[model samples]
Target: MSYTPLVDAEGFAAFPAPAKLNLFLHIVGRRADGYHLLESIFQLVDAHDTVWLRVRDDGQIVHHNPMPNVPAETDLTVRAAKLLQTATGVSYGVDIRVDKRLPMGGGMGGGSSDAATVLLALNRLWHVNWQRQALMDLGLQLGADVPFFIFGRNALVEGIGEIMTPIETEATDFVVLHPPVHVPTPAIFGDPELTRNTPSLKVSLLEGTADWRVLRNDLESVAVRKYPQIAQHIQWLSQYAPARMTGSGSCVFAAFVAKDVEKNTSQNQANAVIFGLPKEMSGFVTSSLQEHQLLGFASD
Candidate 1:
């Protein structure tokens, strides 16, 4: 789909902000500063939300739709634009039109990815050319998940998603089932019985492990306890591949070991089912992305 470009002195710039999955999240402990320490493998997916933007003369940030449930002022897209405007000292403003295809609060990093796209797109559109570290710093202020999107790869994230280390894996495809329901992330994290002390594993060990069955999301049980639909989806997807909850999920995904084999050989595979939300809810199956793609409004 094409977007109508907002007028700007320097024209427009666009970026494709992709969603991500936490292959496994282990919350180790809470620090004295109250930040939760975590370890997870973050893999970006090809499915994405497109954000279109152009510089505005008055330095005002505007978002289309403004997300009914989330406050306009508190939305990450607005905060991200404001942060970039302040950091770059660019007198220019931005008009951002977000095509939000990714399900909100699905543990898919939709909002955070959008925020990261804004930062990255604005840096180029505004001619800021700030270093990657600077962009990451700007992204972190927006949200914990934002920085990892900036890195734009499969990553081993730690320390509330600030710390990033690259990881490589065999090509894999995922079928993610999203329930129409919204699962509040904070509520799951705040659960008293939530596991917060999974022993950390080395990056080398993770690389050597072929069977992902050994890795797990420590928060999955707590999430299942909070939302039974999550548990149900997990059960359904597990029949196809080793499926588990992603982040604090209302969305769960399974990785196929052999895409070709599964597509042709798995005759008994059941039809995919999405629970909680209506059968009409939109969902997707996409492969992992090597790098994030940038999109925007273009004069045609």
Candidate 2:
């Protein structure tokens, strides 16, 4: 149910790079190497960046429209393409065009998802046919979060970000608010005041026993203290639901579930937040996706 292996009408292979929310991020400990051990629920959402790729035989990686202020070489999508080519020794290349709708540095996992998309798409486009685990291993070289996106499901992630256990989730909605400033992950992780010893959680986020309202993001304290804009956005959203920061975030969101989706109440709730937001803040209402669009692309 995850992948449809066909090029679209535009004659380009279109792939979706979806966004994710850390329902709650807990820092359990730190590894000997300095990477923080984490326990988090990663929920995939409908909000996404779209990657359109056309394979080339000449062994060149290209981004048709790179993001502003980001060098084409440094773009994760481009890097992903080149890395896959080099690692697999493939003769094929790609012309990638990105339609970016997610916020950069908002802790929504935009860049990581884009990189996953390229790896997944090209595995299909170039006929490299790597297994999902192999692709996930390659993805880790790009970023810690990259493997989760490649895993392509709602997941419970732990360890230094590579350990993943896919969990079930129903279709859900959220009002995601992106504040104007960037909250650097290093700044949040490096803060001395950040809690590094939150006890581990064992409940299943999929089983309805884990009350998200009681769960908390340990990084939130550090990020909110450093960025007032993020704090303000969280405060505004708190009026409607239990607002929480996602990842080391400048964006905050509140989840909404439906008794009957036919009623369309969740979407309205998301819209209410959007309509009431001040012009300085940006946001959208989005629903969760059960699987990544390229979920079956890899040989699982």
Candidate 3:
């Protein structure tokens, strides 16, 4: 499935908002303002949510289908469009509709990615023509993870996700399991047991290293204690490969590397894992994305 924008008969452009897997998340330090500094490798994946947008000359931004319990005004997608309108003073508004496939609070960056897609899509729909960095700057105000999605590639993310450095990652297949629980990020961060002192890895060191398998999410332990379902999911998936929780919690994934000359082997392995999942468990197989679908929408 291509991430390119597709226009339907009614003139709504459907944009893909791909999800991200934190290959590993580390809480490096905390700021005076209570924001936790982080270091992580953010890997884009094919698993995504789609946002349908249509330019409105009337200057009224509206979400056609807002998530239940989340007001349209407070929704990130709407907020992103409004922010772009306010920033560039673009007279055009947007009618937004999100087809959400990624799980909420699953640490898959669903909402943040949705917001980034909105920013990128509206930049073109409204003729703002802002550079990618400018959009990223605007995205940071929405959420820390938003900028990385706008960055549009596998990245070494640091400093509360405001800093990103594009990194090379192998095209690998993964089986992602989503435990049926919403792990509140604030609760995880506020927990006294959360590790906030992991020694930061220099970007140079990361670039020099050939193997990233040793790195782990420092928040996993804290999350597992708070949400036992996450631990259960991780334990079950680990049987196939060394599985770890992505980002804060709920979704755990295990990479399946292709062996020999067979490229489909990894994907087949991932599918097999998903096929064997227990009755109550749910998951899907997805491959890493080289870059975001909307990467070229914004200028350099």
Candidate 4:
């Protein structure tokens, strides 16, 4: 079923911040600024962390429930609201409460997505009325993946996550396994043995001629070397389908393509896989999202 935002009787609007899976990540090059140039198809999924927002007239952004160890000032949702208020000089603030569901450091883009949702939801809540691209530009300042969530569609992302081109992806279900480990992104990217010379396939991807199944994440090898549990999860899931690590590390997924005659075929396959998972492993079944739930919150 499609997702939607909801408002409670107390006037708190709950906005869904959906997670994302990197179908295939390639490190094509690195810039002089030490930022790695990447090419990946970012697929939106149904797994979400809800951000409940209520406008405040006092012009003070407050986070009612911050994630453990993450201060409210550092929390992406709070930061996003503050950023918007500062950028637009809107004499308004918000109370933020995030129902954190996605795993931390699992490469699921949870924090980034929450930040994006705040930016989208508050644009209207505060009547900022900034165009979507402007908000996307603002989102880039928050996190690389934040802009893509604001972009709000399955996209061929490139250029350190700023460039995005919408791409058509078939509906599919994925069983995402989050290994119990927090991968430090810098360590993985700093590994000397990490591959950084994958050829760019931007042309093929845009032309719709690329065979994505054969493509792979270049960072997987580095991440697996540092965290063997990730490799173990990938190995276990691969037995069911062609499994791979998404984004940096920790979370791995195997896709189940949908069938025409059986509408529930993919979900069933995912459910069975999750049901049979080893007790030590943890994961959930989620389908591809055609667009972000707040895609219409901002105008193009």
- Compared with the true structure, all predictions reach lDDT values of 0.75, 0.88, 0.89, 0.92
Clashing residue pair totals per candidate (backbone < 3 A): 5, 0, 0, 0
User: Could you say which candidate leads in lDDT?
Assistant: 4
For residue 105, what is the lDDT in candidate 2?
92
Predicted structure 4, TM vs. truth: 0.97
lDDT, candidate 1, 1-300, per-residue tens: 333334446454556789998888889888887667898888888778877786788978877668778777788888998888887799998887778898888999999999998887787778787777778877888888888787766877888878888777556667788866678878878888988887777555456653445689888898888788778777766766788888888888877544465454221132233333246444566667765664221111
Candidate 2, residue 107: CA error in Å? 0.3
Question: Would you list the clashing residue pairs of candidate 1?
Answer: 14-295, 14-296, 15-295, 16-295, 56-93
Ranked by TM-score from best down, the candidates are 4, 3, 2, 1
Better-scoring candidate (lDDT), 1 or 4: 4
Instruction: Give the lDDT of residue 33 in candidate 1.
Output: 78
Pick out the ten consecutive residues of candidate 3 with the lowest summed lDDT: 203-212
Query: Local error of candidate 1 at 218, Å?
Result: 0.7
Model 1 clash tally? Answer: 5
Worst 10 residues of 2 by lDDT: 2-11
lDDT of 4 by residue, 1-300 (tens): 233568898889899999999999999999999999999999999999999999999999989988788888998898898889889999998988889999989999999999999999999889998999999999989988999999999999999999999999988999999999999999989999988999999999989899787899999999998899999999999999999999997899999988752668888989999999999999999999989988888889
lDDT by residue (tens digit), candidate 2, 1-300? 756645777677778899999988999999899889999989999899988899888988878898788899999999999999999999998998998999999899999999999999888888999999999999999999999988998888999889898887767789999988988799899999989998877565556688666899999988888988889999989999899899999889998886569998888887887899888778898898877888888978
The CA lDDT at 273 in model 2 is: 76
Regions of model 4 farther than 4 Å from truth: 1-4
